[model samples]
Target: MPEYRAPLADFEFLLHDWLNVSEHYAQIGKDDIDADLVNEIITQGARFAESEVAPINQIGDQQGCTLKDGKVTTAEGFPQAYQSYIENGWNAMLGSEEYGGQELPYSVAIPVHEMLVSANVSWRLVCGLTESAVLALEKHGSDELKETYLPNLISGEWTGTMNLTEPQAGSDLSLLTSKAEANDDGSYKISGTKIFISGGDHEWTDNIIHLVLARLPDAPAGVKGISLFLVPKMLPDANGEFTIENDLSVGSIEHKMGLHGCPTCVMNFDGAKGWLIGAPHSGLACMFTMMNDARFQVGLQGTGIAEASYQGALTYAKERLQSRAPQGVQQPDEKADAIIHLPDVRRMLLTQKALTEGSRALGLLYAKQVDIVRFGTEEEQAKAESIVAYLTPITKSFFTDMGQEVSQHGVQIFGGHGYIQEWGMEQLIRDSRITQLYEGTNGIQALDLISRKLVRDGGRMLQNTAALFSDMINAIQNEADKNMALEIQQQWLAGSESLMSGDAFDTASRAYDYMQFCAYSLLAICWLSMKDRAAQTGNDQLASSKAKTCDFYIKRLYPRALMHKAALGDSGEDLAALSLEDF
Candidate 1:
């Protein structure tokens, strides 16, 4: 079985040295969020993940989830591990103080989340969705709804899920046929069959809260008519006891490519009693709150998986012996040299390291923006909101794409052994694949980046992005680092201009490339920040490692941005010219 060790030192460097989150927390009046408290939380979270959750990974993957008589049973050790997770207060890290939550900043929760996902992403899915649900209910739920649901959800006594997809509706939620009829006591009758619902039904919790999106009886057309509903698997009585069963059932759980431990169910809601969340006909808007949170967590999922894959590959490379090194047989006592001595192997390992660490930095930066949006002043909130909006798609799409690529590299580095199941390299590839497809597919995320975030405001978000790059560039004293940052920013600016000037067809065709370009550029900014911060702190070992990684990223990986930029100019005429008959 593969092993996972939390990158505690990296977390410390990013939180304290690079981002200076402690000062930011103090500025936001969160004096309780010092380095010591943050360290304690991360330490305990890491211990729990490494010890409890990770042991069940292979067991879950092998046994998978069993659905018998509509109730889903998780793999061995899952329930016990989850019980420990809840007992440790891990689920309440980001919840509100008004409920039974710790009320920590989002940034503070991010490292803990990364560790859990890295430990075992399959199990982490349950916790991730519940956190998103807690955020959505806290932001948009009515006073009564909050009082009823927030406590248990935050306390991890019950879990939550987001139900948006149906047979006819996937990305185009407007086609959803799920219907909601008004009921007499201000509740609505929700009837819909939702597919691909993670944590839809699990034995770990007594009840599950589902936030379903459906249209009202007399409603407008398309997404405009949809409204959010709070539907629970078991309804609570006036005394807050879940004794009454609701009209919802788990029709079946999907036998998926990966994440077998987490049950992805086909849920059927037959006139389930539910209450309105936000305003009528504002379902999409309300759900966006949860969707945005889920999207960011998915990005963390990618980073976590990449870290796991890299660790496996690096361990195998050092232990596995191959042919002698090109220069000479350094290990004269042994029959052959380790693969880590090979240049090609070094390239793969460094690529994994550079991208994984870069993704971590970028994600943490975004998490800080989320923290500011929640706790900062009006001016800070406005700026952070724009940054968050602009970076959401990039973070989600880019990080996952990197995760898939890095995992593939891990498999390749292991040679034939990577294809085998026991080493766990193949599982990483299978697990990381879905991150690109779900939470709005990477292609959809790219289009969203181009259409909504970039083009909608006449490049205003790009300008905000450029200002961020400029700040880091100015702070860097090294000429090479400064020049590399400038190059990435310049290319990104030119690509944004190309996207803005293109017609609809051209923009749609090149949006994916543009999003990739933006991701590389943003990662460059992150690398530069890490390099500069490491040097400033007099941490020679970290500074040297970061500098070498930054150099590798610039010399090798950064050129991909240029290629994506060139691809942007293609107009995709050849793609459109191909007829359906060509197939």
Candidate 2:
């Protein structure tokens, strides 16, 4: 069976050495988060994840969630584990201080979140969804709504959910038939059946705060008619406590391929009392504040799962006796050598490490950009937002794809046992499959990257992205491996220019390849940055490992970027010309 151990050293290297997050926090007026405090949080959070959360992963997968009498009961120990999480104040760490939270920077919260996900992704979604809900309510919720909802939600006494997908409205919100009628008491009667609601209903808490997207009676047609609402399962009465049950119930829970512990529900809100959030017909905008945050968090899901898979595979490789090393017997005393001595096993393990570490770095770096967008100086805020907007789709799609790839490699290293659940490699693969599907399918993310972000702005954001990398490379021009950095920057710029020059269909057709190209190139930047920092520290072991990994990435993985660039150059005409009739 697989076990989880948080990658504290890698996180410390990224947060303290590579990204200099402490300086970042100080710059953003977050003077409270010093290196010592940050290390303590990472250590304690890891302890909770490994001890309290990880043990429940396999149990949850087997037992799943039970739905009965319109109430969903999570897997055994889930509620207790969650209560522990709340008691430890994990949920309130990232929220606003105005709502009884610590208001730590995303840079800090993101690592803690990564640990939670790596330890137990199924359980992580419970609070993960609430974090997004908090973002939406804080950004768009009225003062009254915030006063009532924010305190409890931030304190983790109550949980939250985002209701967007219905049976008819899969990805298209225009087909949503959910209705909201204005009530005489200044509330709206939200009546709808929302499907695919993660953590939609659970007995873990007394109240579940739902952020629903519904249309007002006289609202405009299609998406323009949509409005955001805060609908709680149990409405609060005087003194802001759960005093009355709202008209909502769990219709059913999804028997999904994985994440069975989260209790994805088909929620039926029949005339549920809800308060409007933000202006009418501006629901999409409000919900996006949640979606963007969730999208990046979903990306972290991929990184976390991949890290766990890699660790499991590594442990197995070191223990499972196999064929002798190519050169000689690695373990003469034993009948067979450990698989870790094999070349192919090393390749698989190295790929997992490279991708997992790179993805973690990119995710946290993206989170730092989020911090800047929220609290940086005005000029810094504008620049960071532009950069983050350009990278969001890349973060979501690329990281998830890498997760899938790394998880697959994990299973492969285990050979036959990996296909079976007893070893736990299969569970990682099953759980990670949804990361690519939900939070917007990776294909859709690719299309969005091409049509909306890269091409729509006439390449302004893409140019800004190229410039951002170029500046980083320029900053390290005097370093030992500066030439390699310059070469990567030039190649990225060339690829960006070529993709932007294409037409809509041309760009769309090559969007997936282009996304991969950009993801790999950016990861190269991360690896090289770490390489330079390691070289400077005179830590021979760390420097050697970074150098070997950097060389492997460049020599093996980096060549794929060249192939993608070549693929991107195709007009996609031959591919497009083939019609459904051709099949």
Candidate 3:
């Protein structure tokens, strides 16, 4: 099996040097979480992930999940491993302390999450979805709901799943046909089938809390009529004892291309007892609260997978002997030098490293903004929200795309061995393929970027974002670092200018390309920030490596934004002109 190790140094660099997470937390009134504690959490989290979680990745993938008699059983060792996870208090690490949680900031939780994702994406899904569900319930659920549900969910005795898509409803929730009828006792009966429900049901926990979306009898025609409900596998009675089973069952587990360890269930909620979460006919809004959180983590999945793939491939490259260096024989005593001597191999490795590291830097900073959005003063919260709104889709789409690319490069680096299963390289590719498809596809993410975030506000958010980047650029005094920062600023300005002047349709047509351009340029800015910090540290090797990577990103990757820019300039006539008859 390919070994997985948490990139602790990268996380530390991001948390300590680049972002100054401790000071930022202080600014947001999170005084209790200092840097020392943060580092301890990270250290212990890595040890747990490396020793406990990663060893099961390949085993889980090979064994997969099994279902029989309306019950789902996770692969061998998962339940035990999960018990260890819960017992370690990792599940409640980010939840609120009022309900028996650690109440760690999302910024701290995110690094630990990155480690979990890298060690085992499949197992990570269980806790990741639960945390998101907890966020939604905390944000929108009524007091009664919180009192009853939040304790168990927060304590990790029960897990949670977000049920958004059904057989008829995929991306468009308006087409949902799930029915919810009011009861005399003030509860409701939900009857419908929800597909693609991750961790929908499992024997690892006693109860599974499903945040379901269904329409009321008196509801309107479309999405506006929908409402959110808390439906659990085990319904609590009047005495709040969950001894009774709700009328919900797993129809079957999905035979998927990847993430087989996570049961993608078809949930049949037939007259299931449930209670309303948010206000009636506002289900979509409440679900978005959870989805937005999931989307950020899904984006980080890309970086996590990429990080794992890089580690595996780098190890193999340094050990696998092949042709000698192009310059001269570096290992004359050996039959052949290590594959790391090859230029193209280094290119692939560097590409993977740059994108993975850049994604980490950018993603952690985004999580800090999430912290501000949640805990900052009023003014800071408002500005952080706007920036986060613009960044969400980019992180969701671009990072996952990078994950896919990096996984493929891993396979290429290993050549024939990568295609083999025992090496565990292929598993990374298979696991990463789903990151692009789920939590809303990359295509849908692009539309959100174009229609909702960028164009909806008449490019105001984009401009504000650009101004923030401009401030970073203007702060640079070092000539070379300043040049790199200006390059990113100029590229961003050009892209934003195109988006601002273009019509909605034109912008929408090129949204995918625009997202790539915007993400790449933004990552360049992140690289520049790291570059400046590395230079100040005066560590020769660290500063030199950071400088080289920054130069490589600015020269090799940043130029790709021009391709997106050129593509965005077109009228999109060819696509529009091609009619159904033409095909």
Clashes of each: 0, 0, 0
Backbone clash pairs for candidate 1 read none
Models 1 onward score TM values of 0.98, 0.98, 0.98
- Candidate 3's C-alpha runs over 4 A off are 501-504
lDDT of 2 by residue, 1-583 (tens): 7878899988888888778888988899987789999999999999999999999989899999988888889898999999999999999988899989988888888889999999889999989999899999999988988888899999999999999999989878999889999999899999999999999888889889999999999988999999999998887778766889999888888989989778999999999999999999999999999998899989999999999999999999999998789979989999999999999999999999889888898888888888998889999888888889889999999989999999999999999999998888998888999999887999989888888887777777787777767666665634656788878878887777766666778878998988888899999987887787777666788878888888888888988888988888788798789789996
Query: Candidate 1: RMSD over Cα atoms?
Result: 1.1
Summarize candidate 1's per-residue lDDT along 88-166 as a digit string, tens digits.
8899988999898988999899999998898899999999999999989999999999999999999999999999999
| Model 2 ranges with Cα > 4 A deviation | 238-240, 477-480
lDDT (C-alpha) at residue 262 in model 2:
81
Per-residue CA lDDT of model 3 for 1-583, tens digit only, reads: 6688788877887798777888988888888788899999999999999998898888889999888888999888788888998998999987888888888788998999999899999999988999999999999998989988898898889999999898879988899999999999999999999999999989989999999999999999988999999999997778978989999999999998889888889999999999999999999999989999999999999999999999999999999999889978979889999999899999999999899999998898789888988888898788888889999999999999999999999999999999999988898899999999888999899988877887777776787677767776776658788886887678777666667656666767888888888898899988887888888776778778888998888888888887887788787677788789998
lDDT of 2 at 441: 91
| Residue pairs with backbone atoms closer than 3 Å in model 2 (clashes) | none
